[model samples]
Each structure stands twice: as structure tokens, then as C-alpha cells.
Target: MNRLVPLAVVLGLTTASCSGGHGAGSFLPSGAPGAGSAAPASAGARTTRSTAVAAPPAGWATTATQAVSLKSATDLGALDATKPVTVRLGLQLHNVDQLKSAVQSRAVLSPGQIQSAYAPTASEVAQVTNYLQSQGLTSIAAEPNGLMVSATGSAAQIAKAFDTTLHAFTVNGVSAYANTAPAYVPTALNGIVVAVLGLNNVQAFATSPHRGGQAVNHASPADSAPAPQPESPCALSSVFIVGLPSPQPIPTPEAYTTGCPRNYTPSDYWRAYDVGSTSGAGRTPIAIMAEGNVSSSIADFRVNEQGDGLPEVPVVVKQVGVASPDTAGADEWTLDMTASTGMARRVSTIYLYATTSMTDSDIALMYNRWVTDDLAPIGNSSFGGCEAFPYLDGSMLVDDEIMLMGAAQGQTMFASTGDTGSFCSVGNPNGVPGGAPLVEYPAASPYVVAVGGTTLWSQYDGTYAGESAWNAGGGGLSQFEYSPFWQSGIQPVGTTATGQSFRGTPDIAMDGDLQTGMIVYIASAGGWTTIGGTSLSSPLAAGVWARMLQNHPGLGFAAPQLYHTFAMSNPGTKLLGPPPTINVGPFHDVVSGSNGAFAATPGYDYTTGLGSLDVAALNAVIGQ
Candidate 1:
């Protein structure tokens, strides 16, 4: 596809989906409460239990989400009647099915080949523009492929053009306006305009925030110990980092029985994962999707990169609307930047798309820009929408269309599965016992590769031990989406009590346990904070893809190939049940603990998905 953005960047559930769900599973937030440990309520709406049990009053889209009990952040935001609102017009492309077929075949595609095979025809773009004009919309700018058209209109004008209502809602101290009702397009643009965006801004998302910057205990707090700290400044080695708090009065070896040290850096991860030599090396420009500025953090990143003997990488920060630094924004950006660069050592550029807010509308626009930007081939999204949130509930179709567009252009988006384990629909800080499960979207989206987490057990000398499913990694079946054909071969296994044959999450996992977390510079946490969560996993995996692409240039989207290759090269190891001490070529079969509901079994399970990465082995399979 034609690279559009140049080197410059730009850049929930809960709402039951409109898609069909087999009765095999109930998409409720039951079972156990999530970790239930309080997170710094993500910047926009704080996710709360579903209060709107009653259906929409009248004349609402049948698929409209449960009415949320908003706390009105009137001080922070307001809906202005005359202010022109920019709504992205999603046009349905004509040969998308063909594109899917091609993707399934894993056929190598060149930029020109991908564009010619999947881009919307000029006629389709023109039709959408003309139809929007007829509805009195203004400031129409059609994106390159013509599948996206941005138009401006007043609230009244937008209401008249699309059947929807605008209203403001608030949660936690953040607020934004949204289309309270599900919106629709005119018959003139019915098939042409697949979906309209920027309608609702209710649902919000975040990087599954690192609460209090503490590591979660695997067995009990006594099983492992915190990392040793340096009391005297000179005691710290030249390469050794020193931001850790004084070690516990009697530092104990914490984390897995592997006795891995707590203090780690980008280089440590490089050596441990055996990806030290696999570098993006000034070729691939990775795209990190989040919000806020990280000028200082970028400087720190450069220092760390050079410290590791990797070339300095230029970071390009681009804004979607009007994004600013929020509470944990600095830390989020820092970790994402450094870790991704650490893996893809020679990556030329890192494009950070700072969206104005976590509002659903802005997020939709965020993905649209990422895909349509066309500069970055690989993307990393650390945040996720609550399944039942109205914003996400409404934009599912529009979002899917955007993902497919990216896929057609050889773009692959890696999203964080979530931090809340089996109880994805609900917040699980306490790591409670039972709660109905829900999967986070964008990750749950079939087109993207959902990255989960693992409790890495690599030691100081790079000695590898077995990894287990993170107590907090998100997984289970997608309530709305059906299983993708590529992964359909694996039998769906959810919590031990139940199983659903739907789209299961976390195509793969990587180190994310706070105990074994990657070391990152978190300004808000007073310098270096050991951070974990799928937030780390997503970018880590994105970097891996950048590496894979650097070597295997024409590799198709990762989801299909992961399964196809795994099935072909599965060592058929019978670690538990019987004899074969077989070796899984591409995967490191993780069979240990459970996420909450599901146990990490011999084969594919909800937690740890297809296990952690074996870079050398992975390259062998995917590079084919």
C-alpha cells in the first residue's frame, strides 16, 4: 500500500455485541471478581458494574448498550451545538471478502499488490462523499483508500443526518459526550457507508495500569522475595540500574522457584529471550498507540538504547486530536518505547499516536488513523475497552472494518489481551473466585493478534525455567465474535466448569508478571518502575513481529500463521499424560497455573494461550 504518513507519526465491554453468540456461554460478569486490586481508574470514565439493567426506553437501536449511570464531568467537557464535529465515514469496500481469502492463504503480498487487491474503488469513495454532502455535512476529506471519509457537522446537523442523540456522561472525574443512541446511515449510503464513527464517546480504555508498582505473589507472599537493593551508590555496577526501593529488610528470592533476580533491563530481556541479535535495526518504524508526551522519557530511552549498544532511535509523536499527559501517561509511554526499541534494537523510528483521550470515538478514530496512516507496518495497543461499554458496543462493525483495511495493507496490530484474567468483563483486582467472563476488544477482534502475559522464570545468567500463566492475564471466549477459521482447529476451552466454541483470546504470551516484569523508566513512580501486565506483552510481541518482518519480509498477518505453523511443528510433547518428551518447535508449551477460571493445560488453554516465545524457534517456523 502507498505509505501515506511519511516518517512523521501521527498517530470495553460491556455491552453485549450485536453479533450472534451461541448459548454455549453466557457473556455475563459473574464467576469471580477480578484482581479487585484498585487500579488508578483509567483517565476518562471509570469502569463500573452495569447499572442499566432495563432496556432502552423507546426508538433506540435494538443493539444499544445498557444505559450507563454517568457522573457528568460537566466541568471537564461539554457538547457544544455549533462546534463542528468531525465524524469518520466508514465506507464498505467491494472486494474485502477476496482480501480475507488472500490473507487466509498466507500469500506474500507487496505494498502495490496489497493496495491493488484490497483498496476501495474511486467510485465507492465518491459515493460516500456525495452522500455526506447531500446530508449537509462539510469539510469532507477522503482518505487514500477511500474507505474512510472525514466530515464536519454541527450536533443538530449530525442528528439530522444520522439517527442518533448526543449526551454527556461522566465517571470517576473524567467526562465526554457521546451519541446515547445507536446511529444509522441514510439508505443512499447504506451499502456504501458501512458504519459511521465519532458518534459515541462513552466507553474508555487504558494500559491495564500498574497499581502501586508492586509485584503479585504467585503462591503466597512468602513463596518468593523482592530484589536486593543497593544501599551505597558505589555498590551499584556500571550497567546495574539503581531506582529500586531498598530491598525488603531480609530480601528473599521472590517470583517463581527459578530464583530469577528482580532487577532487569532491556538487555536482560534481549539475552533471556534469545532475541539479542534480532533487530528492527533502522528499517521498521514501530507504531505505539496510546496518548500523551514523552520527550523526557524519549531522552531516557535514547540513553538506555545507547547503554545497551543499540543505535539511537528517533521517536515521532503525533496527535489524533488534543492529547495531554495524564497521571500514568508518562510511565505508559516510557515502558512502551524502551521495551519495543530494546527488542527491535535497530528500529529506525517509533511513531507514538497520542489520542486526545480514551473516549471510544477518539479511539475509533485512533485505529482508523493507524491503519490508514500506512507508514508503520506493526502496531502496539496496550489498552482495552470494557466489553459492555456503550462506546465499544456501538462501534464494533466500524472498528472491524478498520482492522481488515490494515490487514489488507500488510499492517498487523498487536493488542493487550487484558490484566483482569478470566473475569474480563468485570474489574478483578482482588483476583476473586467467580464472575461471568468477558473479553476485551480490539484484542478480541478477529483481525488482530491478541497478546497475553506470562510469569517469566529466566535467571541472572539467562538460564531458562518454565513459565506459568499470569494470575492476571485476560483470556477466554469472545462473547460476540465467532472463532476465526485459522484458530478454529483448537477446541475451545474456557474455565474448567464451562467451555465455549467462540473466539478465544491471547494468541500468544510473553513476560508480564510484575515479579518478573521488564524494567522501565516511569516518571510518575520516581524513575524506574518494574511494570507488568499485557501492556508490556503487547509491545514486546509487536517488537518480535518487527523482527520477524525484518527477516521474513512478506510474512502475512501473524494470527493465521501462528496456528498453521504451531499445528505443523507441534512436537506433540506429552509432558504430563504419557511418554513423548517431544519438543514444540515454535512454542514453549506453558502448563502450570491458571488465569483464574481455566488451568494451563498440556495444550492450548485460556491462560498463557500458546505459551511464551522461543525466538529462534519462532523464526524458524514463521520465516518459512
Candidate 2:
């Protein structure tokens, strides 16, 4: 009966002492050397891992003498040996270098060209599976791609196999188990193994939608505004249907617009981008992979689809693994699904994949299932975390490998850069003093197209005025990853600004400001909120790609072709085709605003990347 409880919990309104988070596991710098320098062996495991999880040496064991102590806020009491738990073991992919070479080579690929060349070889799978069997951990299930192996066993057995002590720990203010020391694997699976996961449930990955704007539950003085109430329940059809705090328990995708902010709807975005009418239906399916449930908003989705003028497309919901069926954050998931379907209305279908939890392994496994299952040709992952932590330590983000496979098999991935402006690490939940600013992961991976954010300040009359970089649009230099040859147009970040530069985000930007954000039905937020963030850009882009693929049959991995022409230019020169001075090409050229320290420059800057899109223009120039 207390309104405050639901609001506080639903809105992430908890202090360190209460909510579960990456607390107690914050990164502490012990002065590690840069790449190419003599760093600790563990610290020197060079790859894209260096830029993200291993930042400023994150929490990984940098020295032989320096054992990584995954400290706990509480003693966690003791671990029960009899209790069974699931642990994830990671494996390295085959032909990693070759895959990178293909992506950076700036070659337009044919469908199934790259995937045919790169895959987890049988040797690698045998090497991992053989080792796991040797550990007496027989309950093993290899992922569809064979990049990972999941097994279940008692706490004691799992701990011993991982060469660590299992300790009861808490994260996000919830009780869980974790490893107290750096987990050790056998020599057979050492280098071939990127990292292990599921050892600690405490630091399991948690993701937030990139949407910007304050979310309020119940009633605040701000909710009383009557300027933008919907005329009917289905009036705001393209809106997201979210769930509110507990006790309202109906789990209905209801819409109420009496007390919501005014913002652009999916229809508005369609009009803004001039998403030309295309009867080219049955092109590609847009699969949205996220945590939590999707069944809650199916009814509302049809309403939005009809209202948006999108042809009736089959909408399907499937589970990656055995995730919880409980209705939690249902509305957030609905937002992504509806937004994507609304944007690329001609798609063949929409597949929603959910994992048991947002843990690192769960997220990765779900993605593995989606890709391996060949669920769709286009993928949208709008989840990421602050790049300052060792998200790659126990469980390495094998996302790049998976993404490469996707690209090879005619799939293009679009991920949100982040929503924390330039300083994506500013408010790390770990509560540690993060050394410097950075962008979020998956976006940092060169294989995935990092979609950034922007604010469209124009008339709501569906006419364009001008645009600027969104203040909260995430962008910055990757501390570890170097820019590929395709991305050589941007200046590298090392001392020389030479060929040795860090990869920049994002490759593109779109409408992502609360004022000019997406207006979706949020069954949770009472009705609608002007939502904007790199999250919105990613799915929207995926939708656009779907539309393009309809006309162009084999537009596999568009980034390479994109960079070879429009986005890439000489180091100090303006892009050749799309003049930076005008708005005539694929991009709108967001030449204003800043995301923390980085400003949107004349051409491409970290803030808005190459800028918003002219969908028709982009698809035309992509391959030819």
C-alpha cells in the first residue's frame, strides 16, 4: 500500500547500502604500463580486451605477485558445498585475425563470405570440451557457435575446477556467490580461452537502456501537466508498454497519457527521416535481444504497428535460454520491440529473445543463440555497461567474435554507444575512482556499428530545422582498440597521433534527446515519455538496414562500404562525397553540441559520429 516503495525500486532509487550493483568490485589502479610496453603478463593479454574491461588495468591481476582480490562488502558467511550452480566457461574463436583483416580491409562482402571462412573449428571445441570433461564436470552444453561451454555442478566442484574459492557475495544489493581470487584454468584451455564467466554471480552484467530523461513513478508535481494527454488509450500506439512498480500487479500493457511529457512519436521519426514508402515487405527480420519478458506487450505492439501504417508483420517471442517468466521491466523490452518494428515496417518478422538474467554469460549466451539459430539477418542490442571495469576478466566479451560471425553470415549489428555523454565512466556503480573518461562496450567493438545520439531541434510539424549533438550521447576514444584501416580518417589518440590511434565512437547518430526523443507507449510510466539515447539510434538503424536490404539483396556488413566512401576521408581532409558543409548526403552532419569533453566538429567527431541519416541516400552509396 506504500507508493514510495515501488517508485524507489522501479526507478533505481537505492543507496549503496541497499541495491545490488558492481559495488566492492571497483577498479583500483596499481600503475600498469600501456600496450607495447612491458606490462604484467596477465595485464598484457593484448586484444580489444585492453580497451574495455582491462582499462587502467581495471581489477585484473596485473602482476604475478599481485593476486586479484575480488573483495566483498560482507563476509558472505560461507558457501554451501551441496548447492548446485551453473558456471560458464569461455573459448577463443578460430581465425580471429582473419576476421579482423576482412572487416578492416574495407572490402564489400557477399552474404556468407566471411562466416564460411571463420568459425569455431572442431579442434578448438574439442580442446575446450575435452578439458571440461577432464575436470569431471560432465554436464556441459556447448553453445551453438562452439565459442563457449556451459556446465553445472556443486559449488565446491565448480570452485575447484575454476581454481578459486567460492564466496557468498552480493551485487546490486542482492545476495549471490562469487570468486574471492582470480580463477585459474588448465594449460590446455589457457590461451585458447579468452576468459571464464559464471564464477561470480555478483558481477554478472547489468544493462540500462540508452534513453535519456528522468523517469518518475506514481506522481510528482511534473506529472500534472495537461499539455500532452492522449485522446484515447490507443492514441499513442507507437509508444512503449512498460510495467510499473510492484502491487499494481495486473501486468497489462495499458496506456494513460494525462500526465506525460510531449515528444516525437515513431510516426514523427518516420516523417523526419523520410523513410520512403516501400512495398518491399518480407525482406529481413529485426531481432531485439534484451533481458526480462516480452509477452506482456504483444497486444499493444499490434496497435502500434497498425497505427504506424506498417504492414502487418509476424511478431514472434522466443527465449534464448530458460529465463525467468516473471513480468519485470516488461515495458522497457516493449519499447525496443515497438520502436524497431515501427521504424522498419516492411520487415518479414520481429523476434524477441530474452535471457534468464542480464548477467554477462546470460547476455552473451542469448546473443550466441540468436546468431547461431540464424534467427534473423539484422540484430539490435541496446545494452552496454561503463567501459572502465574488467568486463572481460572472468568472462571475456566474446561479442566481437560473435559479431564477426554475424557479419559473415549476412547480419549487421547495431549497438548503443551509451547515454553517459563523453564521460561514460563518470558515475560507475562500482563507486571507485575511475581514472579517465571512456565509452561503453559492444559499441567499442569494431565489428559492430556503434550508433550515437543527437537532438533534433525542429518544428513538430514534421519538418526539419536543424540538429545538434545530444549532451548525453555517449562517445569517446577506446582506451585499447586501435582504429581499423577503414576508420583511419579519424586521428588516433596515442602521443604521435600516428597510425597507432584508438577506435572512435559512434559511427552514426540519430534523434536521442528527451525534448526531441521517441514518444512510445510506456505502460509503466503511465503512458509516454520523450525518450532519447544511443539505444534509440541502434534499433532504428537496424530497422533502416532492414529496409535497405529489401532492395539490395546482399548488403552484408554495411560498415566497411560505409567507411570506404561517405564516412571515411583523408586524415585531415573533409569527406569527399558528403560535403561537411552541407546536408546533401547520407548523414545530416551534426556540427554542434558536446558529449562531455568531446565536441561535434565540422566533419565526424566523437559526439555525433557522421550524423543522422538520409536512409535512401545511405543505401544508394553503400556498395556502389
TM-score of each: 0.78, 0.77
Model 1 stretches with alpha carbons more than 4 Å out: 1-80, 110-117, 170-174, 211-245, 249-261, 276-280, 306-309, 322-328, 390-393, 425-436, 494-500, 572-583
**Candidate 1 residue lDDT tens string, 1-624:** 000110000001222222221222111221111111111110011122323223322432122122222322342333566756777765554455566676677664565675565655687788878877987988888876665788889977886676666665554554556665555554444345544666655435543347334321121112222333333211111124432344432133332233343434665566656774454556888888876555665766665565455677778887886656653355666677777777766676888888876655577777878876777888887777544342233455556667766775678898887776876644432111133456777787778899888876544344444567888888887654555667767745532223434678888888777666765544445544567778788888888787888878767677787878777774654441111112367677787767888877766778877776767667766845
User: How does model 2 fare in lDDT?
Assistant: 0.56
On residues 1-624, what C-alpha lDDT tens digit does candidate 2 reach at each position?
000011111212111111111111111112311111221122111222221223322222221111122332554645688778787665555455555566565444543554355555667778877777776776788875676778888888877776667777453476766555545565544445555666655433344433433332212212222221233222222222222222111121232211212245565566567665643466778888766666766655664555445567787777766768655546556666767776776678888777787665676677777778776878787766654333323332455556666665667778888777887643333322344455676677666788888766432234344567888888888754455556756443432233355678898887766555665555555454445666677777877777788877766676776666564432333432111223636667777679888987766688887777766666666666
Each prediction's Cα lDDT score?
0.59, 0.56
Instruction: List ranges where model 2 is wrong by over 4 Å.
Output: 1-72, 105-117, 171-173, 203-262, 277-280, 394-397, 425-434, 459-461, 491-499, 567-581
Worst 10 residues of 2 by lDDT: 1-10
